[model samples]
Target: MKQKRDGGVAVTGTADKQPNAQLTSWFVRSGWSKGELARQVNRRARQLGAHHVSTDTSRVRRWLDGEQPREPIPRILSELFSERFGCVVPVEDLGLRSAQQPPSGGDIDLPWAGPQTVQLINEFSRSDLMLGRRGFLGASLALSAGPALLEPMQRWLVPTAAAPRPAAAQGPGAGGGRAARLSEQELQLLESTAAMFREWDSQCGGGLRRKAVVGQLHEVTDLLQEPHPEPVARRLYRVTADLAALAGWMSYDVGLQPIAQKYLVLALHAAKEAGDRPLGAFVLSSMSRQMIHLERPDDALELIHLAQYGSRDSAGAATQSMLYALEARAYANMGQVNKCHRAVRMAEDTFCDVRAGEEPAWIDFFTEAELHAENAHSYRDLAYVAGRSPTYASLAQPEMLQAVEGFRRDDVHQRAYALNLVGMGTVQLLMRDPAQAAHYTDQAMAVAKRVRSERVNTRIRKTTHAAVRDFGDVPEVIALAERLSEELPEVAEPA
Candidate 1:
């Protein structure tokens, strides 16, 4: 039958029963209630390490009443059915395919040139501001991949330039706008504003000023549309790219993975246009960090390799040290202790070689404190791989203590202090000292309550989960359990 749908003419397949009918048939054959099926799907998704997959009985009931699921969920359901039925139950067969196509335009891919890069920054900033943080969680998996990710890392070796200087005679939106007359004063304003944003992010956590940063990015993107001399244009692109990267980093801090990926990709494009290979390499390192957090160490390694290949001759010693530190993280996660040690040595050697005033301003945060923190984390992971040995556990403690002291001296990044406490608590737990571990865990939770950061909160949750799991019989552990329920009501109760 032919019918009009969404103001367009449509054709229906004769074999296509109502989605509800097909869904009901499957439900009856599987002999599982809607709630049970939803629960099973959620359980499987979690096993697959997929985040933000929420399927409830009421949602399943709606699906069975002829409402099609949005993207990814349909795909997720197909996989679940295939596993249960021992056959290929495609998304099409399940009648759950969404009508909307995935995002394609807006420079979702890198190497975006000139005006397209400007368009992407503007579009992404607006979308991120409007959606806040939670809305992007749905397509976090899909947007994290695709050509957008692969092509950029593969091409980071080749430097690209921004658009040619438009004639001053050109009008608005025609290669040149009113910015042909831009002055050094205006450029300095942009740089200083970005620095302020970075400082705020470092001190208070990103959530407090995320929206304001987006507004700043929107203004910068508007400035990019104007025509300028080649030198001014290059400087503008670099400044705008830095702001965009900050936006992405803040989004990541708040646990918005998809939005972070989008902003970072666009930042890479802008950096490329600015002809700043080091900046582009830094952006690639950020992408690798995100990939590692997502538990894709292979992907993370690929990105680090690209950064190394591109920045080999150009990057300063400080930047080189940061890259090597990140590489150590990847190797550590993969349980390659030897390679991890080699990378750490290289990082230390390069860091010592850093000459004062030679390093770029952006690399300022990669201090000795940060290096020790990274090593501490790497050692902790290596300990797990080496049968949870007491040796690595002992090694992790001093580094963590050093990290804590550094963060405390700085007095800006309270979250880092809290994170180190969590690490110390974990080490204590592994050492079979439940009482001391509970004390550190309690301290971390108290500090975490003051920070508006999801990242810090996650670290606290992991430490508490460990406490509730291993030291449940202890009084301190019981107190921490009550604290978790009160502080993080949304988290599932420990098993």
Candidate 2:
């Protein structure tokens, strides 16, 4: 039996008990001052109502040896390192995975292990970063291993009476029982994870790695369900809820509608438990986006309304823009041209109010270029519904071109450019220019090869196939269509 910290373990004689050497190396390479890291962790712990406690280098050393830190401490550690290094650091870096690792039978014995909390926060931050980069590829992959890990984690999070008391009750001078302190090393893990996730979100699509993100969400939810002091529990719940919402969004983007819905429901419950009304609204908005994709215009519209009503007082520009944009999408889908335009105008106005450094952490994905690109999509949709060729052609060309340019320049974003080109192909087909339509469709097909996004590939195939059908006899169109069909066999199937 492997010896575990916090309790006596049944140890077989002569088994190795060395700490993880890789983790030790990572810590040394991070270049953070031990004192500065400790100070940040202590400060964050206080903010979260953790009992004031003196933490030192020796305490951190224990963490490096694989001991999990107590509540609020894990979060504090993450915050401190993230602040210091300007990047995310997950608790796993501190060897917390040993604590969260399942037994031989693949069952995690301690659902609310302190180390698990650190891991959860780290994953959440990573998911955020992934979403900001590439939409939601991570969620698409959730079916592979995410749900399995999450279901069990959620099962563990169901509240229990024997849960540990809050850290504050156990502080140095005032306690019959003292809650354990998180080590400085653990805090650094949290910080590193957050920064890494932020970077990933900016550079890659969340849909591609959603399974890992959901796995993290499950762990956070489990932590929230465990017994902790009210203040500590509340803070944990807020962070978990935010991550869960992001999980749902990434799920939706990857076309996992049912899975996305499940995540959204759980996120809503978590948000309510945390008393985070704004987060709940954000989750609803994410659901609205899913509804729009499914072409359930009425449902999407209602979700938009709910989000707007719920977040009316949040005073957040990004939230307002998301709500308005969702509303605009719903109206456009329903062929309510005037209403769509009005909603879009409101979205634009809300975006204008978004001062730098003032936006909430969650809605950081909306860049100026992305916003205009979305507006162009809404216009294109409205044009289709209204049978207004000129309007569609005018907005589609420049917007799609700009979108393609932005995405193509960055390898991480090239998939999006391909998808935008598919939209461009549709617009060209609508304008009766099969030649230009074929050209853009061919470009989209070419770009699709570099990305693993089924959603983008599917859209490209559909649009290109439609264009081919419209001009099947033309030699250039036939050749382009043939090439695309070979690359994407799904396009050869009947609509």
Candidate 3:
């Protein structure tokens, strides 16, 4: 809750410990000219969900003259300096620190109360849908940057001391009708549309209908502003959270990880407001997946613990199984083979007990196939840690193949199935069978052509890299390499 110093004029009394000196020294050490610093700061601000800023060298000059930039600008400056210097650079160090104030969650806090959550979602949805708002850093820093986003979530870990009391519905504003009784038909329509969106995302990849889902989520937020009976309001919050979470999931699929993180955090807010502890837990679990993909295994582990904490004892077999599966992945990344194996066993055991209707509908994607596929990935990771043992490859190939086949039988998530095909291909290549690896890779490409998933493309790239690096001289590898080179320049001829 640190405040920034006033930007109006130069402050006297400490010229020897000059704020200007600190700014100048750091600015010089950074090797970025004043203009470059301005550009980078503005970019980072946008990523942190700040209003549009076009800071310039003149603004930097003002800082050098002992005047501070207001509020978040100082915070943004600290972030850039810390990232550039590889150390913690507090606002105090930047000479812009002022008296502490109450924490408002620094632009990312989800209001779990009433209409504020709806307003937050509306603003976020609009900003995200507008391509002009995208930062130059893109989505890569979403989870990788770590603490900025995690700090807010860490605060969310503590439950509210008082339970939320429902407020009377507000009368119609200029935009829409007053609070009205929520009809059964309205809820049914939302549920059906969500189901349809899920099907489309699974079949054709998130790119096929991501915008549609986000727009629907914005529409659903309107229902939150309307007054309903306590029960109806609670149900409305739950469904809205579900839609928001879906939007986040699709954003992840299409490689907009920052936007995905934003929506997921908002969804977590809505879920908590609805008293849907299980859904809240799932959102944390989803965030953990994003962290792992960002290569932040330790951060991912923290999110896993938070997820399990939310579920406590009420989580069903399927939910518990999925959580453990994610834990196994986290451990695998950390090279904790024994812990990873134990978690895999836990997931396997719990999934065995999952009854047909035990799982929430949203988690229908976490079937036996996903468990097997993730288990294979965990095992494959152990092999890397243990010096690439052929034994692990032998074990991994069958599990990945089973996953691909399972997805095939369901006739859903073709992108996932294709990605697993690439996994199997990689395992075969590691086991020194170029011909079989080529066969699997070809099959994967055939399926992959129908989907627009960055994740699928990433797997395809890995498979191709293994082929070219290890067995490029082989005729089968050569042919597949040629095909990949023609189709994906980034994968075949990486910079």
- Evaluate residue 113 in candidate 3 and report its C-alpha lDDT on the 0 to 100 scale: 56
In candidate 3, how many Å is residue 151 off? 4.2
Candidate with maximal TM-score: 1
Off by over 4 Å in 1: 1-72, 75-107, 133-141, 146-148, 160-162, 169-179, 491-495
Per-residue lDDT of 369-397 in model 1, one digit per residue for the tens? Answer: 88888888878877877888788888888
lDDT by residue (45-138, candidate 3, tens digit) is: 6665564455778878767777655546766676577646634465667777533322443445555555677788876776666642344333
Point out the worst 10-residue segment of candidate 2 by lDDT: 5-14
For model 3 the TM-score comes to 0.75
TM-score of each: 0.79, 0.60, 0.75
Model 3, poorest ten-residue lDDT window?
136-145
TM-score, candidate number 2: 0.60
Measure candidate 3: CA RMSD: 7.8
> Once model 1 is optimally superposed onto the true structure by TM-score, how far is the C-alpha of residue 194 displaced, in angstroms?
1.1
* Model 2 stretches with alpha carbons more than 4 Å out: 1-207, 229-231, 409-414, 491-495
Using lDDT as the measure, name the better of candidate 1 and candidate 3.
Answer: 3
Highest lDDT model number: 3
Residue-level error in angstroms, candidate 2, position 401: 3.3
As a TM-score, model 1 comes out at 0.79
